[model samples]
Target: MNIEWSALGSVIIWGILIGAGLPALFALGVKTLAVPAGPDGERHPSLGRRVGAWTCFGVIILAIVGAVAFIASGGH
Candidate 1:
């Protein structure tokens, strides 16, 4: 019946940062990598490819951080 507000806040913040923030960043990366024709509607680089690369990078970083945190937390 007891709740730890600090732990709850940490979880919420990490969830938001990983869940929404990573996707948003990936979107930004994709947008930046996209090539647009001058008023001709031509496109290159492919949004999907860019998004994948961004997501992979984000996931790697998250995994490393998570691993370090887990080790530091004594796996508790």
Candidate 2:
């Protein structure tokens, strides 16, 4: 069969975005959640940390959506 470049491009782009974006987002989140110790030597996640975690969770949701779409697209 003849090769299809546009389909290949779509698959490649989606794979790259999903593969790289998710991990980068998660790492950024983990870094933010890592709170430095105060004089009490206790670390706590601030509101920003919670929000970042939620944002990463949202990214995970988006990734799952993308996966569903990709599979439905029949890329394989």
Give me the candidate number with maximum TM-score: 2
Model 1: residues >4 Å from true position, as ranges?
A: 37-76
RMSD to truth, every model: 6.3, 3.3
Candidate 2 per-residue lDDT, tens place, 1-76, comes to 9899999999899878878878888888888888897788887889988898889978888878887998999974
Tens digits of per-residue lDDT for model 1 on 1-76? 9899999999899989877777776667666666766476765566676676677677757877987999999996
What Cα-based lDDT does every candidate model obtain?
0.75, 0.85
Error of 2 at 39 (Å): 6.0
Q: Name model 2 segments beyond 4 Å from true.
A: 38-42, 65-76
**Residue 67 lDDT, candidate 2, scale 0-100:** 77
